[model samples]
Target: MRISRCVRWPAVVVAGALAATACGSFEGSTTSGSGSADNLTVSLQFTPRANYSLETDDAFVLSQVGCLETLVKYDAEAGALVPLLATEWVQTEPTAWDFTLRDGVKFQDGTDLTAAAVVASLQYLLQADAPPRAFTPKLITSVEALNDSTVRVRTPEPSALVPFRLASINTGILAPAAYTGTGIDPLSHCTGPYTPVAQTPAQSMTLEGNATYWGGNVPLKSVTARFIPEGATRATQVRTGESQIALGLPASTVPELEGDARIKVSSAFTPRTTGLYFNQSRAPFDNPDVRKAVQAAVDVESITSSVFGGQAHPAIGPFAPTEAWAPDSPPVNRNPDAARRLLTAAGYAPGQLKLTLLAYTERPEFADLAAVIQANLAEIGIDVSVQVSDYSAIEPSLLDGAYDLALLSRNHLTDIADPLGFLTADYSCGGGFNISQYCDPAIDAQLSAANTENDPQRRNAIYADVASQLQADAVTTFIAHEQTTAARLETIESFVDDPLARYAVTPDLTVSNS
Candidate 1:
């Protein structure tokens, strides 16, 4: 992994900085926006790890930040599907789909975007060494190049959301050079509005607009992005003019940043959900009664209102309220007494049961959420110790069953339009992200049925049934689905938050000169 140092700026003069920048009343020169036609700097909440192609989350985010392009994209504002590398697509048969590649599109390496390249990129995602295993939809059986501009997709079962699946970051088409003997070349072989000129793995990256891009008018010429994992640091970058745009500001910082006239805070409700995953392979949690007890002990309203400042909606199930297939289920009610009773009946001694709760500090609120759970579980006679660290460090413990419970945030519909992709990835027997090591044959059957079902109504009904079953079984306890937030200079006019985090850095965004 190649690590690079991030450039730092001097302390911000926040006393009257916003007033001076907004009103243009200061006499002396003040550092503000780029004040140019096509140059900007953004601060990202998450950083890219080494081997970008192997990591699905890194690919999903960087693809939007101008590094790579997906075959299709979702327009959150329009609530419709938009074209990227693939211009048009259709379902020729129940189990087969066809896509026509956009002409004249060139990769960063000057290679043409062809059907064979798309197939190779998709194939790379299924490699044994892929970081995010099971990123692609499980229904896909094979990908074949029909012609220079056309591609065919085959699924083991009839899939209605094949186009949506292709639009995922895991399917981002790459140049042939990226497919090396053993791994993918991270900084090369990508096609997007912007191309990486320099990158520091997990720290910062510099990008220049692609002249050969098929997309219209690449307004932004250059972008320097610093990955500040700390939320407070990210907000600081926005206020200090070090970063023109800051993505993923913590909810706690929104009120303070909103006070600045020059800093604009924006948010959009997304399909992402934060929840507590129980390791069923571990003792006590292996019992369904104990899992239900922990679920009953949690207070979702308190966490949403007090911890999040009411910026989020309590999760009813895996799918958010914005999802079309979300079941009209009520949020879990807090029942400490019932939780204690269940714990005692499960042959656990009072005040002697102990467990370790693991959580990462990336989201800023995760630590606080863990504390809330700690306090809530204490009442039910479960002694809990919280361990907070980075996700990379905690992931090993999660996978190996070193922790009794894990606090995880997941986007249920980011990869696929339907929630099945996330369900199968996080819950099934072969789930790649299954931290809890949970496997239920009944739930697996329901997920398979939903994936193969062609009828929309029937598919959704099956998904609803699976959601109910998961909740009833207490596979994981849903906390809340938060609204994605970003902070930028008030001069940013065309900044729009895409729910899936794609289509964020486009040609239309511009900063006002006035």
Candidate 2:
């Protein structure tokens, strides 16, 4: 799920929410089952970025998730990383290993999956200056084409997390064609269960199944995705039968849906978190007390019960017990009294400090939650201004530090079964999605040390220490690790979550109307 924030409030304030509703990159989707409808229409919270490229971020990649298999794909059902692309992998050394490609597989584009193509896709993703660049495949030092279906990937240093990085969305497999004509640009060519029909950013996307796909042919003849930002209206569409599958339904609407037997919600925890971001590089937040005051003002018990209802839990930390890198000692999540003392010592007066809270309006529940928070903060003597808008405006607001505070969310992959990949992305000084812009040399040193340590217990200890310090710094307020509420028609069977956030809907699974 690619959660995006809405932009609003212009220069005064910016409000945002975490809502991912588009499907363009491949994850295991639509398992072997019967079609609920000859044609299926699913509604996403946001429109796809584009349907034009076979690039990992493109819409088709959503359709082929977990199937094209590289090193591994998240299997929610089994709660582990399973193989799809490479049958299996072995560690040659700390920094080097060879992947023996799965044989007899063909791309949806009908091209064979060869060693050269694999090499190309791997290199393109790791080296490309695009979204996949966020994957930092550059951690890989070199690639060696061992044979027609074999390639050796080498890292400059001893690192066991190499293959795990390849399981991210940005690492979705690419077709040979996405390479040939594209001048070293791996963004074109395509691969997945369904071929891209067409896509218009901020509008909609349509897809068709590839009959010649090596995995198998799709059941539904067509899939059209509409981008609808209004949460209530989208929920109504599900109720009225205008939309068959509604992705990213607000938590508040879930209860009503649960009452409607006609609908079935298939939900799982996404490796994502909804939280309060602190600009550690700047003031008040730079003062531990101010950060704590904000934390104290947040009533997660109230937030969870009133706003989230029964849908979510008050988040104590980021990684669920499922993550390989989940800290054995999670950060201290609650310190309301300490928060008060910190604010008092920081010389802050109630209502004296007014800050902007940024969020998007697509998920109305979050907007409502912000209102609740605003009221709660007011009780604590902190004044907060609420700003809400479309996703377009919220991003720059984050980068420019236009608002004193912003409501943000992150969707990441546990591709390697550890915190190494996600922590690196979230903490790197100039990371791809380091919204907080947190730059701590000490933290970075710890992360780097963990990366090079091949010993499991020792590495986890290092990561745990990093997590502890961040907690002490109140670097960020950790909220609930959301368990998504997604509805699949009864005809939908094999859909499962890999706990790690990746899913697969391959064609090998049969779909019947029943």
Candidate 3:
């Protein structure tokens, strides 16, 4: 794991010292945290992954483990990018960049970190069957290791967001030896602050501090990360002191934690959205009037504020809410009158339209949303039935276009600074993440132009047009972006609420109880 500091203990226990003679796995330091309970635990929101980059949703949980070594890391202290795995890097050409790897860095498996391994890890990403492989890496032509500690990556054109993409946990480096079977054995990748010692289903994983990490040893001798998918019980774990930290607490329960002085709440703009994607190539979805009618059937504001307790924002289109490419299309409020007119224009009468919706059980809220949406649509002459199952089932269902409509929550990264990352995957036919199977030659042309375009403003305008066009076409029912909430005991230090959390660097992060 990456460490920025080092410490050693003497033979005797010294007063006010972190450790005595016996060495433990964690650490002997305390930052600003007041509570250093003998035992500490954190509740995880999802299960661990065997394949890293293939599944974007798993990044949040996997970030707790090892990841890729990049030229820079998010400098939370400075609120900008700072040197990390790479001491310093020089930008040669807009697309062709050179990096000088840090000296004396070692992987978790005793392998010295080198440019060769970094190159291999990126090649692995390019080879993956995931959408990013074909889309992002298609812009890349070569990755050459100039020396043991220097590497160069050459892309098709100028890429301003390359560094940001490098910082993504999904792009974290994997040891050359870590590759096993057909894909990455993510559980064994060596580059993080901690690694798993014991794993128990529906229970907890005892993560011991990585001692050989160059980044520095964690202060906690061990961290027990429990997988708690249940929303109410997850919050209870934090409120009742069963666990010091709870991840993904529903916003409805935030007030309960706020009521407790011992608990602190943290939240950020999550790159997640709950949406309904239509099979645009088929049936009623092919009709623009039917699509517009469906959009007007849902009341976005009430659904978010009332059901999510103000934890979510209405989604307007494919672009992330804060993205520059996000269009000005506001949430379509329920307009039964308008919906009826459109439905009639499409030759659909009351109760004449029927559609099936597919949903997954990965999130506790998906079923609830589907049920609410199904009931809501019944009032607007549409009949919907939700087919719920595990994520594995839902994924294949979406890919095969088995369901007329589907409920999906997708996480996004700032690939190329805007919707290029998501649209290329979701809107293009045969695209890796294109569950909707949507295909519009004009939309594809615009997206393709934005991909290679060097001008930022021009690219954003192109993507904005794509967003507006998709809305007008009714390719998907843009629901809302559910907020991700984190609750921790007040004793935790360096508590910064964020959309992308990097808690490993917290002030108390290095502190441990042995």
Among the numbered candidates, top TM-score falls to: 1
Please, what are the lDDT tens digits per residue for candidate 1 over residues 1-514?
1111211111111111111211111122222335475778777777665456544566755665777777777555444557778877877777787888889988878888899888877776755354344344455678889999988888877766677677677667778787666455645468877876666556776777888777766777787777778988888888888888887778888887888888888777777888999988868889999999999999999999988778788888887654656777888899999999889889887788888888887788888999999999999999999998888788778877778888988887665656777888788898877787889898888888877666666777777778878788888999998777888887777877666666556667776665
lDDT of 3 by residue, 446-511 (tens): 777776665667777887788788877778888887666778776665544444443432314532
Instruction: List TM-score per model, in order.
Output: 0.89, 0.82, 0.83
lDDT of candidate model 3 versus the reference: 0.64
lDDT of each: 0.74, 0.60, 0.64
Q: Judge candidate 1 against the unseen true structure and give its global Cα lDDT, from 0 to 1.
A: 0.74
Identify the runs in model 1 with alpha carbons over 4 angstroms from their true place.
1-35, 131-138, 186-188
Tens digit per residue, CA lDDT, model 2, 1-514: 2222221111111011001002233332332212345555656565344333333334233543222345455444343445666666666666776677777777765678787888877776666545443345557777768898777878878776665565555566667565544332222234556565555445555566666655555676755566677877777776766666666677777777777776676665666666888766676677877877777668777777777765666665665444454565543444556666667799987667777788887656779878977886777677788899976568676766655676765554443445666677677675655667788888888888988876666776776677667656667776666666665455544544233334334554333465
RMSD of each: 10.4, 8.7, 9.7
* Model 1, residue 395: C-alpha shift (Å): 1.4
| Residue 59 CA displacement from its true place in model 1, Å | 0.2
